[model samples]
Target: MKTLHFALPFVLIAVGCDMSPDYKQPELPVPSEWNTADDAERDSSHISAIGWKEFFTSPELQAVIDAALDNNRDLRIAVLNVEAARALYRIEKADQLLQIDAAANSSHQHLTEAEGAGPDGRTANHYQANLASTAFELDLFGRVHNESEAALETFFATEAARDAAQVTLIAETVNAYLQWLVDRETLDLLQRSLASREKSLELVTARQEIGLSSKLDLASAQAAVESVKVSRAIYSRFVEEDRNALALLIGKHDESLLPAEASLENTTILEDLPIALPSNVLLKRPDVREAEHQLKSANANIGAARAAFFPRITLTGSVGFASNDLGDLFTTEAAGAWSFIPQISIPIFDNGRNAANLDYSEVRKNIAVARYEKAIQNGFREVNNSLAARRLIREQLDAQRRLASAREEAYTLAHARYEAGLDSLLESLIAQDDMLAAQQAEIDALRQELSNTVTLYKVLGGGVLR
Candidate 1:
């Protein structure tokens, strides 16, 4: 007992020696600055610092996003995963400490005469009560310590994963909502176009009956009306499909949550993202952070694997009182008893099992490193692509609007000429077709431009503040 007391300090001192390698964050593998053509004089505040509600200013969209955050199944599962990882980390940390338990037992044994008992038979009873710690390992080589560290890193990784799920969910919900609005707007446009084409067909039929227009003109007007009907049908299906998709994202079918009327132009989404921000901001992205945590966990696992090559020391002990009679077990007259069992296990040979484990840990760490780098690379590419899309889509939308305006003017002039008998009816019909196509293209371009902005915000990790 005295020897144990004297060696306790030395054991504690030895525990300070950790075999784990010092951790250092890897260098960024991307460029320092964005390569976009946009003005570099944007807001310097990080996108992640901007809350989702602040960015998505539409009340209807905010409500839908709030519902999704509360009820999304994938996000719920991510939260549960974080909790499970936290519990497992606590269990691993507890293994580094002594676990004491109280126990009491009584036993009776009978000896027969054939077993050399005196007279007929003999009976003996024993009782004991104790507080014992079973197989408490002393972390002389930091194996248990590194295991705890690995578990802690794993917990962090799970938490980051949950955040990543949340960011993705918000982005998806916003995209879905925008798509629904776009489809509705397109459907409205198609319906109006169909009505106009039908009216034109009616006019052509009346003129043909009066011998003022040819059969070809009447047939052309009919074909145009049918084409508009086909487009309207397609957009009608699109609107319903968009609603179904949005319902699944928001986790409910509450029609009141959606806007009564909305347009891509009127949907309020902030565009204050700093396009000139350094690429290092990718580190703040939840998926990238999750990958880094995983890499850190793998690094900690290598430390545990290295420690497995050293000696392990365990202690099992109990302090108790024992007596032949149960009534006397807790009395002063009972025999006082204690035990100290210290064991040391040296790794003499293991047929290369430990070596194989060390190799496996190293390989896993390498894989984690690769994944971390890949995550950063993917983030860089996404940001660049979004930036490019934002600029190009804006230009495209401008060009489409101009084209629509020109086609509208051309259609008006062609109609006037046909009414005055200066041009054929077919020329006016062609101009009308061009005007409709241009208007549809303009609407599509506007939708694409707005959708691109939402995507840019998401890829820049802008939704995590909420």
Candidate 2:
């Protein structure tokens, strides 16, 4: 027994060599810095770490995102997926430990005289009880360990996916709310334009009757009124549609909880997000993190596959009491029974299945590596595109606002001149048309800028609600 005990340690030590390859993170082809404005300083602290509540200043907007986090169906599914993956990982990890069970059995048998039980047929009864461990494979080459590691990585990947879903939900909710505000603003402008155009048509018709304006000028005035009416109807529809989208994102159609007619001018989200290094995006973005976890999982799979080519060892054991009488089964008079089995399976010959598995694992790892790199590349592209838009959109929005102001002034002056008999009705109508278009353009630009801001937030892995 002493020698047996001494030799068991050596056996375990000999089989402790891991066949699983070491995990080396795949090198990414990422730039050191982003192509941002020269004045923009690099921020080591990624903006993604900011909480959603802290990033969004509007109480109404924050409430909307909170509702979505609680009620969004897709986000709920993502959370459930993480739970399932965690459970699967636990199951896989449990395989590396012993599994013991308590067992009890009774048997009856008839022995014939030819079986040498007795001259005549006799009945025999037996009873036994024991604790036994079923066949448990020893992780000599780390097959079980690698498999567990893969499962753990898979769990981590699902968690990252959940975070990615959360980011999307927040971005969508904020964008929809902001868009609703823009549509409301445009609708108000169109209504005011419609009223002005109606008054102009009345003035032009009165002048035509008095021989001060031509029928053509009157017709132009009428067309402008009808055009503003059409624009009003379109924008009103946009407002309603935007409301419906927001309701869906929040996972309920509670109109009372939805944001009331809030003006875009009053709405304020964070204007500047910290700009981290391009490579940091991989760590900040959940999708990129998810891809890295998948790569690690594939790497672990290769280890498991490699281990499959080596000999597998398993052990089964039981210790029990046995007796012909059921009452005596647990007594000292009962016979002590025990069993121990150590199994070894050395791969002799197979139809190239093991080699094929190894090949498949290698290819899968390659696919994972490619995917990981692609994720980084995609993240970099999104951040760069958003940065480019961020730099140019502010300029565009400012120019549009200035043009709208100029057009408004021109329309006011032209209208007063037409009423004072110093200008033609055609001139006033043209100025009014230009002003309406310019105002609408300004609103559109504002909406684009707001949408771009949400995109930047999402691409930068803006924080999820805790």
Query: Where in model 1 is the C-alpha error above 4 Å?
Result: 1-12, 37-39, 42-44, 111-123
Residue 400 displacement (Å), model 1 = 1.7
For candidate 1, the per-residue lDDT at 91 reads 100
After superposing candidate 2, which stretches have Cα over 4 Å from the reference? 1-10, 110-123
On a 0 to 100 scale, what is the lDDT of residue 311 in model 1? 91
Q: Please write out the lDDT profile of model 1 over residues 194-220, one tens digit for every residue.
A: 887787888889989999989998888
* Cα RMSD, model 2: 2.4
Reference-based TM-score of each model: 0.93, 0.93
Where does candidate 1 have its weakest 10-residue lDDT segment?
Answer: 37-46
* Residue 466 in candidate 2, Cα distance off native in Å: 3.2
Clashes of each: 0, 0
lDDT for residue 98 in candidate 1, whole number 0-100? 95
Clashing pairs in 2: none
